[model samples]
Target: MCPVCGQEVESIYHALFKCVGAKNVWELWEECPMVIGTENMDFSNLALKMLECGTPRDMELLIVVAWAIWCSRNLRVFEMVCQGADQVWNHAISMLFDFREAVKFCGLGPLACEVRWKKPQVGVFKINTDGATEVDGRWSSIGVVIRDSRGEVAATLCRVLPGCFSVDETEALAIEARIILVRELDLHQVIVELDSLLVVHQILAKDFNGGLGHIVHGISGFLEGFHS
Candidate 1:
């Protein structure tokens, strides 16, 4: 039932590192490992061995390449789109290049580091949301937490959504879910927190595109109720 190679494979490791499509990518890679993992090995074990076998940079490259493979597989499944192994490898290389550049540049600035979450005002509540897709891309899980000024949990939730969703779409779903939950509770004022800057920007501008955009519009509509 695997989409990448048209195989009835159930192994995550096989899908990402051993299948014909995935193998094409690794073979195209300049430093592909001869012994990445066996087809039947668990993904966690393979990942642990990879971590133990390489430098931090090596680990980062492995992760990025693996992510590219997943994206490629998802595109093939959900969109009926296929990118050659060369293209997938190039995409990952580009991402890794951008990431290294960012890290290098960010290391120069003290203010470029991550910031911790702060509590909202006394009268307002804060809702934080996050979403992550599973390895096979068939499921996405979202987590939402609502906290009051005293840092007490007002409400918390977790759900597994079925489908292959883009990262943006998944993040937008989390925001939408959070908005709906808060609205249902009739909370007057609430501050939302999410890590997806793209979604945040799109929402702030009231601009959206495709499936993610549709979800954002729904979220924007819900915002109108809170102004009263």
Candidate 2:
């Protein structure tokens, strides 16, 4: 039964991909392909379809979406917080993007998201980063890890920043650290992957803007070393 609404016994299908509540969760996007005839389909098939048909970026988005949907369901079942699919979707993207930025700081890029889904193979280096802060007698931290193609650990670091800071800044800092580490190792033709679109774009852009000069400068220097 729908514990929140007391209407009917909601199957996993209804709760995850088809219910009114689920629809509300993803309504912000132009549309989700899964909503069409989503009934009577298995979750594995749904994931397969998403992977078989979508671009690399789309595949990454789907991973976050599926994860968010699962998260919402767990929260609803245990905590009674019926998070709408739209909100869950947004949260999924935000979390994934921020995570990407953090991992990329260590010189891992799109491949990090891929390795997350596919698991890292032998001979790849993965770097994980974390940030911490003290709040009202407690410490909280957020961390992300990146692995190279062979799934080896290249870099892992955590910071206790001791104050309030947005996840974005931490992500940017992580990227900076990753790139610096990569330069120190002096590997030629290494693949650097990151999850944040903003950080990726900033790193790839040829010109440096003023506001994030330190980060941009660091990344630019790394690239110069790589090219030289």
Candidate 3:
């Protein structure tokens, strides 16, 4: 019997593909043809078929998801912990996105602008924020590092958040938390920096009432307290 779920005999197919937990993860990835057409085939056959039928990106995602599921299984067995299907799915997609970004950067010739930290203006404080989630776990964390114009750390905060639906949501949470931290510190003149350009753009736009509308609204409210 499988030590993790105890629902069936331990086998490669059962452990990786057929278990209830694995099925939930596969169902979330229904956009993938391999996931949509899962059959009672052996593990190797299923993997080979995925490679043969999937596009390059699809294949990459498939591999990442499989690896995530395997890692989740191992974590459950050894650490007595389990990750939900949504968490596993989000983790796989995030990994694939990071891999693709890295490949794109490597493909571009040397002129690509390198990112480096710069100090804030003389009277302004800078808050750098970031968020990260675990591939084989459910929770996410947001961190904020506040620095003065002299490039010295003023304050720092780290928080563990519940499982986020996507990286964008996690980033939004980070910015929101940063705003709250600024308010608590009474830092009037401040600048915020984060790696996610999408979140920054969304915040800059005047009318952004999409999925993260509430978070954007919260950020706007907090910004009013800052020195213009």
Candidate 4:
């Protein structure tokens, strides 16, 4: 029904496309490549198509705009949260700039962009410790924490391994992964510590007789000549 007639209810299509209420939104999207003309666009298809196109920066902008549009739409309908076009534009601007700054600081340039990896300065040796609980004779989870000599946290990592494994195996695997990651960053001078004495001893001995033999073998080989 027309506004003059005072319609009782409005459909999403009418509100999003046909209504005067949405005219400004359409115009805004026209300027925003991410959500422009996406009213009737299939969400999945649009996402994939956009992903296929554009550099990393372009994709980042697209993601922020798309998310902002969806947020604005949801705010208007279900939550009864509504804001003017200026507010929405401000929202988009804030999101875009923030994400842009983050990506830049993280040293993640454009997709497939030429990036020279810089080695981190080695201040002190660090070790990331981890644990995995046993449940029902099957492995539950892995918890990892990295710390330097001063007891300052360097990093922490955790994840559930596929299939079942013992706590010792999980700990060993975490230590091995940390060493590889550190080596990739080209920072080799550091001490590795683990609460699990067996894992630490195994690592020192360069022995892979444990359950996670393959992983230990590879890691030991890589760090074999490094000063402990």
**Candidate topping lDDT:** 3
Model 2 agreement with the true structure over 147-186: per-residue lDDT tens digits: 6665655555455544333333445566667656665676
In candidate 4, what residue range of length 10 has the lowest lDDT sum?
A: 1-10
Q: lDDT tens string, model 4, 127-179?
A: 65675644233444666555555666676667777644445566666777777
After TM-score superposition, the amount by which residue 40's alpha carbon in candidate 2 deviates from its true location, in angstroms, is 1.5
* Backbone clashes in model 3, listed as residue pairs: none
Name model 2 segments beyond 4 Å from true: 4-8, 31-37, 82-86, 108-228
lDDT scores for all predictions?
A: 0.76, 0.56, 0.77, 0.56
Check candidate 1 and list the clashing pairs. 1-8
Model 1: residue 15 alpha-carbon error in angstroms: 16
Error of 1 at 212 (Å): 1.4
User: Model 4: clashing residue pairs?
Assistant: 125-190, 125-191
Candidate 4 residue 16 C-alpha distance from true site, Å = 69
**Tens-digit lDDT track for model 3 on 1-228?**
987678889887887788888888888875776553357777667777877888777767767888888988887887566768876776676567667777788788676557578998898999999988654446789999999999999999999997634566688899899898888888899999877655676788843565556787888888888884
Residue 29 lDDT (model 4)? 48
Q: In terms of TM-score, which candidate is strongest? A: 3
Candidate 1 — what's its lDDT? 0.76
